[model samples]
Target: MTQAKADIGVYGLGTMGSALALNLAEQGFRVAVTNRETAWIGDFVKEAGPLATALIPAETLESFVSAIKTPRTILFMIPSGAPMDAMIEAVLPLLAEGDTIIDGGNADFNDTRRRFKELSGTGAHFVGMGVSGGAKGARHGPSMMVGGTQHSWDQLRPMAEAIAAKFEDDPCVAHLGPDGAGHFVKTVHNGIEYADMQMIAEVYGLLRDGAGWDAPRIGALFEGWQEGPLSSYLIEVSAAALLTVDPETGQPMVDVIVDQAGQKGTGRWTVIEALKMGESANTIEAAVGARGWSSEKSKREIAEPLLTAGTLEAAIPSETDLEAALIAARIIAHAQGFRLLGAASEEFDWSLDMVRISEIWRAGCIIRSALLDDLATAFRDEVPHGHVILSPNIAETLAQKLPSLRRVVVAGASLGTALPALSAALAWYDSTRRGRGTTNLIQAQRDFFGAHGFARTDQDGKFNAVWPDLASEGT
Candidate 1:
């Protein structure tokens, strides 16, 4: 028996887990992995190839935990929720004091909190880590979000910093806060991603229906967008997805694909959190709604019979105007996401660092973009202002881009193309700027129906009004 010490033990050897293990091995860390089956274990070991020496395979749980030294670090990359809890239960007996268990899953933040509490005082540290950038990202570089104690982070930082994607030598990884905070931010990241993708699809719909452009035509435009302010991983992939030609039919690949969008629930979770926190994540909420509506084909078919397949109404908004509008819309959507995070931070006393979040997101994430560089800079000397929009540089940019956004929204409404995300973005912007909104009538209606009472603008106290007699009612 070649008795050797392993720096870390990875308990799952699925695609992402295997890739992460390989990445760890590549960084010169001795990675021990375990799974129920031996097939993936063999495949992983063989694939490790020249780097095989750094890979350790433990078929049993006891052997896996035994391979690591004391105060051991074991990372669980299993499915979130029940499976995660089960794994923890199975591993608890083998663990020692100061040992750490990191959950690298897309877990609900509430679930993460539960796990953190369950693992507390057991002499084992629990960390909820959010790993992004998919399979390739896991193998090469990923944006890592960690929530745990300072000591737990210290133990993991060296490996994390080494493996993460770097922007100007800055690693795309952060110890966001303590317990559930990392997963919460990651959940919101996915939400912003949903909004980004949905908005892109909405824009493409406008291009297709309003401009009478085919997939390749639109794809080429998206390709062009990759070079400009809208440059990002999502935009780049969108171009690829649109441009790909199906080998079987010799047609645009995107043309044959189904329109029903698939979701994994993070987007909905974000909207739920927003509602709970009373933060207006309207742009993201609209995107999630648009996806749900897309799945109701029967309702759409029924509605389609009654609607006109309208032609181009107004001239398609200029490319320049559309791009400018997209920039502003992107800003608003991301700001809403951060707004939610800020609220969560305050509510939980997480002391979340907004700048670090943006810095890490600059690379190895679906939402990675050049814009994050600007956002990071804007947050570098943040003056405790609640919104990123309040940053002088960002405010100046929004001021410049507002006109383009207005023009695009007006054109979309006039031409009758569905721009739900864009329209919501504009509505949110407008509502934020309005010091006096038309909510007085709403208050009055509430008071009349439920006696909920209302606050007067001229007075500081809450007031209730007695029902007034009308011509239709007896005095």
Candidate 2:
């Protein structure tokens, strides 16, 4: 057993796992590390350099478990679906009562829930933890969302908070409910991230295609935006990407790269869950759809010339209007995400803290922004209408910024630009403000075709409208 007693056991030496192991070691916590490829364990320890003193290398799963102290806390940083299940099956036998197993990946929340239930009678505890901020954040400080039993939280809290990102000296880590709450929140965070990136890309397209602005010019503008309400990690990176010059070709780095966008299913999961819950996340849905459309590179290339709409010389919107439009669309997208979280919280009895979620997201996550500070403030008390956007401060901000979104969407439509995410955000916002909606006609049509009942606003119960038979009338 090598006589190595450690505070935590880290299984897997993937990019994220290695970074996190190093992070734990740097924080003065002894971390026992192992990998499926046993040879890599030595290399990982070597790469860790001075931090190697704190990393205990174990060649086998048994050795890994043995190196950790009693009532062990083991973190498996592997792929989410089947691999995680397999790891759980493999490790459960080696653990004892009061031991904890953590799944630290972008997991499907349903699976997290199932795993939690699966371990109910077993003595070992299961935790589903969401770690954000990418590999760099893992090595330094990442925002962490933890979900598990109170016992598991108590076991993991000290190490988790020690390695987590900070907002004004406050660690960006929280024990958010139990079972699937952490993973679910992370999914929605990625969904909002998708919308945020798509909206930013749309504005970049507008500047590049419609206004004929150079990449550096657009990049400079985005950099300046970081000082305002739009300040966030995505904006910072987008600016950095745009401003970078290719050494070999002397062109902008972004210009040389392929235009196709890639996704890893988290955004799609968010949309699917929202739909299943009878909620609307149109902006996120649109962002997912854009990524799908981006994947059809060959089809897009073939249809480019054949599907041309007559081009118009559209007026370019001012930078002020463009910034305002981004802020407005961003607000609506995040609001929709929050509503979905609220719905899930109610549905599963998670009792998620919206204010804390927003607060943690202010630093380490990809969607971290100055806007999240405002969102945290907005959710500090009960929102007026069960929605963040309806809060007085948020409502006033949206009212001030909405016209710019309208103008930008109109301009994009006129210019034949594909602004799916921005357009969807505007559409959702417009629908939200209307006390009466067009869905009544949809209900009427459903009743006419399928005898589905429709509720009348003037009456108490559902009623089917009497209508002329379409077949008889046509005959």
Candidate 3:
């Protein structure tokens, strides 16, 4: 074992861990790697091919620690929560002062904050880094959101930038804020992702059922969308997925797959945290609900024949209108996500920079789109009342596209097509625009039944109304 030899150490040889280690090695940084399954170490180093010289495989944790130089940096690419806690406990004894331990996983921000505090005064620093782009991105270039002490950022920034995805010439990596800010941002990122996917699926559903378009036609439509404002990795992948034929059954790949969508809990976590903060993430909530609804496959199968809501004969929307509707819904979803980020920043005192967040997300991340460039400008130049949608450029864009969204939502309602995410976005937008919403009636009802006490429009204090009992009068 070479003592104080490698630039950094990576513990865990999982898909992401291996890829990231390889990426670091390929970037000319000597990397020390180890895993619980020690047998995989030799294999991983060997598979590195010519890059093998840059990789130092350690069969044990002690040797792995010894391989890294003073003020060592170790990235743990294991599952978050209990597994991470176990790794921390195991590795803490082996580390010296000034060492940095980075949790590079989709951790719950609450857990990250807890761990961050726990590591304080212990000499070693703990960094909660949210890494996006999956395995391939890890191997090539991924967007990294780092949240820790400034000291840790100073130590990690050089290598991070070297291995990160680039937009123009800028790396898609940033020290967002302290403690758990990175993970929180990543959580909202996934929530917005859920909304984006659901909205796209809703559009596909409308085209399939209402317009009676075949898979190939829908695939072509999605392919064409890639040329415009909607050009994004998700749209490109969706087009590819739609166009793929299942060679086994000679059917569209989607046709052979089950409808039940799988979730790994990040979307649900986003909704939970948003509600806890008293913030609105309606589109994300709707997306989470849609996934839950999807899981009841048996119930849906049984109810399909038994339930019937009378469907009105609906006019199919034009492709241009559909494109406009998707763009508008996407804007609403991202705005809601950013709003939640703002609320969280206030609550946590992280002072998150929305412009930097937008800039870093423009490449490597799944939601990378041209739209984010506009959002970055909105955050940088003029976001009135802390609302991105209120920015002049975004507001003008929304004004033009919202009518198309409204038309699509109405048509979907008339067709009896489920459009939870899209409908939620439209509803949120409408509610935001309304200067006088019917919430006054809701306040009155709450005060009437629960004596919650409503504030009067004409007065400064909360007031309760004394009214006749309607039930007694009816009897």
lDDT of candidates 1 onward, in order: 0.90, 0.94, 0.93
lDDT of each residue in 1-475, candidate 1, tens digit only: 7667898988889988988999999999999998767667887798789888998898889989999977788888898988998898999999998999999989999999888888889999999999999999999999999998887898899989998999989999999999999999999999999989988887888889777899998899989999988999999999999999999999999989877887889999999999999999998999999999989978888998798856446767888888888899999999999999999999989999989999999999889998998888888868347689888888888899989888888777777778899999999999988999889999999998788999998899999999664555854
Q: Tell me the spans in candidate 3 whose CA falls farther than 4 Å from its real position.
A: 1-4
- Model 3's C-alpha root-mean-square deviation from the true structure amounts to 1.2
lDDT of predicted model 2: 0.94
* Model 3 lDDT tens row, 1-475: 5333899999989999999999999999999999999999999998899998998889888989989987999999989989999999999999999999999999999999999999999999999999988898899999999999999999899999999999999999999999999999999999999999999999999999888898889999999999999999889989999999999999999989888999988999999988999988999999999989999999999998999967998799999999999999999999999999999999999999999999999999888988999999999995998999999999999999999999999999999899999999999998999999998999989988898998888989989999679899995
* Candidate 3 local Cα displacement, residue 50, angstroms: 1.0
TM of each candidate vs. truth: 0.97, 0.98, 0.98
- Ranked by lDDT from best down, the candidates are 2, 3, 1
RMSD (CA, Å), each prediction: 1.7, 1.2, 1.2
Q: Which stretches of candidate 1 lie over 4 Å from their true place?
A: 308-312, 469-475
Kindly indicate the candidate among 1 and 3 with the higher TM-score: 3
Name the better of 1 and 2 by TM-score.
2
